[model samples]
Target chain A: MSGSLQTLSDFLQCLIVGLRLGSVYALVALGYTMVYGIIRLINFAHGDFIMVGGYTLFFTIPAMLAVNDKLPIWLAVIVAIAVCALVGVTVELVAYRPVRKKGTNMTALITAIAMSLFLENLAQAIPAIGPNYKIMRRMFSNKAVLNFLNISLDWTTLLTILIGASVMIGLQLFVKKTKLGRAMRAVSEDKQASVLVGINVNRTIIITFAIGSGLAAVAALMYFAQYSTIMTTSGTMLGLKAFVAAVLGGIGIIPGAMLGGLVIGLVESFTTGYISSSLADAFVFLILIIVLIIKPAGILGKNVGEKV
Target chain B: MMNKNTKLKGYLVNTVALAVLLMAFLILNANFKTPFYSVVFIPSLWQISYLIILAASLNLVLGFLGQLSLGHCGFMAIGAYTAALLSLYFERAGIFTDKKAPVFIVSILVSLLAGGLLAAIVGIIVGIPALRLKGDYLAIITLGFGMIICNVINNLPFAGMEGLSKGSAAASLYKTGLGFGNTLKTKYAWVAIVITILCLAAMFMFIRSRFGRAIESIRDDEIAASASGINVSLYKVGTFVYSAFFAGIAGGLFACCNSSLSTASFAFTNGSILNSTFIVVMVVVGGMGSLTGSMLSAVLMFLLNYVIKNVIKASGMPLFVQNLFKYPMLVYAIVLIIVIMFKPKGILGTREFSLVNTIEYIKGKLGKKAVKEGGSK
Candidate 1:
């Protein structure tokens, strides 16, 4: 009985970690799915926005913490989100807008890839941000608030889940009740029709990018807090995983992204615990391939047959 | 009969142009023992050939079939490892021991074929399910496949091993013994050049055949092509397999010439020859569906990379300037964006350059000048 209980506790512990990781993936995946919904193009650089946000915090948090040891998490979160949104909007306007106007889908796709490469290489080349890891300062103590039957719940884990749930609920309400959210939905459904009906399609798209990027910023903070390190290329793998999560949940669906993120996180955690940690990535990709093959529309995505 | 005659003439012109170019290089390599030729030009020649093969193969899928696959490097890595393992096995079996030159040539041939075949098999397996999807989904799936391949290779115990030890920890197990250290001390420039030309000819012929027309029709309109009874799925899978085959052969050549084989070499990161972005950039800049354009851009990009690296090394520039020059990918990204924005169709834009076209262009220019003079008179 004791052995079984211990095993149960271990499993539950893994679940808690999975949930924490899933929330971060959910936040980033929301950005990917939203941008993809609004524009048919996959914003390849969306992943890089997380990296940008990470670097923003990497630069800001240490200096602020040095000046005042009691810096609020909210202040850091707001500043990072603002900077990330600014960068996201700038990228959409400067790099993506012109290409979107005068090119095919292939061209736009290539441009997005180019933008990804440009951002990554530029970060590496900059003297201040050379290819090195920056250790992120801790914002809160990871002290256990609850312990029951050999299972402990930490403060950081609680905060991650609470923030994630609140943001998700808030987003759900915004999309359902707000005028801007309605405009976004209308534009995604039919851009021409939405424009005809007096929705600012471009503005809606920009706001979508802002919201997505801001969420990515939050994800970046949580990720850094957990990992305690930030690198120029850290976002690549995380972004890819979140993308898989989004696709697994049925892309362009909000709740689906959340569910998918959690599922992927659980799968990864279980694989790492049971199987070889190194092969965990391979398994994740294999799952992605299988999911794509079996249900290309994803779990919650509607299958729209091609019109002849 | 006239068409046949023109075709024959076209072949003759192309052969002569190729011969002249090869002869120039051979003469320079034979006589000019300068550091410039040996250190830079020769290596750059082989690298250019590799890139051309990669770009042309990817063009068949991306440009001709209208499918985006971002995992060409995965196939290349497959080929590289296959070739490396085969050569090592042959060396262990003691087949090519006495006569070094013949053995080297035979091993290279075998590795290329074996590597290409294996890669094609993997390609077909990946393509069957992946091809059912469209656009960005296909791209992501393919990217996932590439990463899977990289991780698998990194984790696999090298050459002779008992069991799969964890991830990249197994990298320490294998020894890459194929290239410069063991082989005959001769430049591989000529071999790469010949192989590149043959691959180009094969791709060109395939593109102009009836099957090529079907592929192009599918690209133009999938529904129309399907209506015309074209087996869309078969053609898509076939194109992908063919592309992977060539990519594998290129990988074999790269493994043989460069001699260093690491999983990182095949990753989708900056500065790796096996990177998908670099290959896509080559095809895009060269003009999609134009073999000549891909070839031209491949050579041009190689030269640009070489120049940037060398110039940075030679110049006494500021630290910041030198730092910028250290990453050629930054320049490549800028160029890619500019190309996509301004000339989305690329430098050639589905147009091929030929000796006949060049002659006709010159004659047309002369005729126009003559007409202008007559009008003036």
Candidate 2:
């Protein structure tokens, strides 16, 4: 019984990890869900954009280090986030805008896939950035900062959760109050109708891409902060997980993306801790399949009547 | 039956092209020890052949049948593992000890059948649930299934035996009834290539049948086809099965070529992603529903990769140039984006290379009055 209790404690510790991890997923998922809501095109390159964000941080941090080793962590993170937001906007303008104008669904999907491949290849081709770059190892890579009685937690974990929560809250306010958010919502409802109502669909899409990419930027920073070393392929698995989170929470529903991310994170952590690390993903995917079958509109998603 | 003029032209073209390529290979081979021919030619042959099979099969689903799937690698993994075990087992069993069973030919046939069978089964299961869904919804479900399969395979005990890590030296109970014995493991490259070609041939035949036309109709517009009395669900399942079957065969061929099986290899890693992306690109760049286009694109992609890998290396470029080859997903990602933006329908765009279509054009030019009369009715 004591042994089982110990395992339970370990499982709880993993839950904390899962929650932190889920926060990142939520952030990234927001980008996928938001863009999908408005454009109805799944931005496959969203993950690669996250990779670009991480790489940008990787390079930017070094330049900052050239001036001084003690670059304020918060400042470094902000700069990374800003750069990622710009990259996201650029991706939308360069890769998506043209296809959106044509308005064929297949073109966007294929374009997304192609853009993803292009970004990945471009990253690979860049000097000093290849398959694996062990950006300076830090003492804090795996070190936990705080402990709740017996549950140890890391600074990165806390930051991930905090940033995720704040971003979601920020997005909620932005969507509900801000003019651009209204424009975004209008566009998401119907692009043609919104344009007829005097909205600039192109501008709204750019903003959507900016916000989505900005969230991915936050996600990249947290991801790198937690792991320290980032590989070219890091964005892929995480991106898929975030996509799952978005779907789980009811894709296109802002709050749903957040809820979904946290839930997926907890499930992964608990499963890995209680059963085996190997089964965590299997369990998460199982949940996805079940959720999809039960509620295709997603947990928070509204069911729009099927078009005739 | 061969027309003398066309046959002569064909031979002349093949001869000149081969001669030129051979000269180029030799020259490149001679200088800077180019490593170009050594690296490019052989790998290109193998890679192009594989892509041809993959892209061609995928076209059956995506272009001809208008269905999409992301769990393709799962079928492939199953096919590969099946072939690997079969070949490895037979060799160990002394069935080919005294004289090696033509492992290449026999194993390929076994792998193809096994791949087709396994893929067909999974196709039925997936297609049944997906029948009601359309477009993006179906895409998500298929993507979910792909992820699930990858995770389960990665997490599951390799064939239900615990602690039996891949390539581990320990004796496994599931080893075919063949006693553990010394066996020769040769590079299965030829085996993989031959199987890929054979599968492509079979697929070409299969698609040209009455069934192929039905699939084309379904792809053009499912509702219209169904109203014309086609069973939509049945055709969807059938097309999916055909696609998966080939994907499975490709997977089996991969296992033989790679000589190792790990969940990671087939996971949606950059390598598998590249394979899938290239297949999609090939289908698109070549033209949707055009077998010739798909094959040409497959060859083109292989050549592109070869050029990128070798030209970058031979030029004595920085170390990062080599790393670029190592991370091809980025390249694939970029290509897909570009293709989508510039040429969405791909190269062939539902058109095939038909001499008859060309002849009809020439005949119309020669007899404009006759052509107009035919249309006037």
Candidate 3:
């Protein structure tokens, strides 16, 4: 009986870890969903945009550390967030706007991919910013500890989940209450109609990208906070997984993104720990396939009849 | 007045072009003693050829069939790994055996078969879902499938190493059959290159055929193509399988040339593999729906990569930037963006060179000249 109970405990413990991890996926998924909701285009580079955010923090955190080793964590986090938002806005203006103006969705897809690829390579090519940024080695090696319900957890894990959840709630409030949020919803429903009502469609698109990318930056910071390693290619798989979460939750729906992410996280954690780590990705993909088949639109997605 | 002469000249031009290409290949192989020629130039040519095959095949599906796929490298990796395993197995069994026929040819044929069949199966599975979804949804699902395949291969317990060991597996797999270090046998690289080139040529011929026209029509407008009695699903699956088959062959050739395999080579996180997508960019930049354009872009991309790497190595760039230069995907991304902005339709833009277009152009030029002479008169 004791052995069985111990096994159950371990399983539950793994489940909690998965939820924490899922929160991060959920946060990133929100970005994918929001942009996808309005545009019906998957921003292929959104994950890389998140990487830009992470890289921003990667550079800024070190500079802060150099100035004063004891600089407050909140200040460092704020700098990272602000820098990521700037990058998000720039990516929207430079890469997305031109294609959007031309009314070519395919061109936009290709452009976003090019933009993402450009940033990744640019990061790899820049002398000061490339691989020797030893800051990851210094900051990520240390772990903070926390205990709950007879289970011990790392402080970074707890902090990442907290930050991720708070941002989601914050986004929820922004979308539900603010005028900009209402404008964004209108634009998503019908771009021409929204424009006719005096809404700045381009500005709203820009704001949506900024907010989405800002959330991605938060995810990036939390990601680094948990495990401090960052590489040029780090965002590729992470971004893909987050997009999966967005799709799983009913892409373009807010709450659905959160639910989908949490499910993915738990599934990943349990599979990796209990089953073989090799099967982790395969399992997630299988789940995605199944979900898409059952609900082509997603759990929270509205299944609009094909107009044909 | 010059029409007949220009026609003769065009024929002469084509013949001379062929001769020059043959001469260049012979000189490089037989006369050139430069290490640069062997290590970089030859490989770059081979790489471009491989990219041309992949991009052209992909265009049949994406450009013509209007299906998006992020799983192209998976097919290439499958082909490569299968070929590598076959080649190593035959070399170990000995070229001349008292029992059964020589396995070398058989092994390569089997590898191609395996690559084609395996890719077909996967393509069929992908097509089922793809048939339902349009646009970005299809792209996302396909991307997901690609990641899954890459991760699975990386994690496979081959070569006795853990956590996606590619190099070690190829070594062990090779050693198990060939008595070890046989991959270092030099003749195989030449053989692999020959086979790869031949396969690419065959693929190019197919793309120029009438069937290729049917495929292109599907891409231009699937609904119209279907109304014309074309089986949309069949063509989609056919193109997907065909593309994957070549990608697999490329993968097998990669394994043979490199003498090893690793998940590192197959996954997108690795920049080299990401550059695999450059073939698509090349196709677009050279000209969508033009096979020659695909060929041109492949060669151009390969040359750009070669120049960037060589320039960085020689220029004494700082270590970080130098390391960055080693990854060509960045250059691909930048080139793609610039090309799309200035020339969105690509260089060829669905146009092709032929006797008819060439004659019409000449006739137009002469007509203008005659008008000038008449005015002067």
Q: State the lDDT at B163 in candidate 1.
A: 21
The segments of candidate 1 whose C-alpha lies over 4 angstroms from its true place after superposition are A147-152, B98-100, B159-176, B181-186, B271-273, B316-326, B366-377
The residue ranges of model 2 lying beyond 4 angstroms of the native Cα positions read A1-8, A59-72, A136-149, B1-43, B98-104, B155-198, B205-210, B224-228, B271-274, B315-339, B355-377
lDDT per residue for candidate 3 within A1-308, as digits (tens), equals 47777787788789878978898899889888888888776776877866777777767776887899887554565776677677878877886776676735656667777887888888877776675433452333245475544566776677777877888889899999999999998989898999999999888988898788878888887776766777776777788888889888888889999998998998899999899887898888778877887888777888897432
What lDDT score goes with residue B267 in model 1? Answer: 78
Worst 10 residues of 1 chain B by lDDT: B159-168
DockQ category of candidate 2: acceptable
lDDT for each residue of candidate 2 in A1-308, tens digit (9 for 90 to 100): 37877777777788788888888888999999998888888888889878888887777776777788876644565776787778778878777888877636766777777777677667766768865666733423456787654778777677678877888898999999999999999998887899898999888888888889878888888787877777776788888888888888887778888888988988888888777786787788778777777777778877777443
Against the true two-chain complex, what DockQ does each candidate achieve? Answer: 0.74, 0.44, 0.49
Q: Pick the candidate with the highest TM-score.
A: 1
Pitting candidate 2 against candidate 3, the one with the higher lDDT is: 2
Tens digits of per-residue lDDT for model 1 on B12-79? Answer: 98999999999997787678777766666666666788889999999999888888888889999888
Fnat of the models, one by one?
Answer: 0.79, 0.62, 0.46
Candidate 3 segments exceeding 4 Å error: A59-71, A133-150, B1-28, B31-34, B96-110, B158-214, B273-276, B315-332, B353-377
Report the TM-score measured on chain A for model 1.
0.96
Clashes of 2: 19
Positional deviation of residue A173's Cα in model 1 after best superposition, in angstroms: 1.4
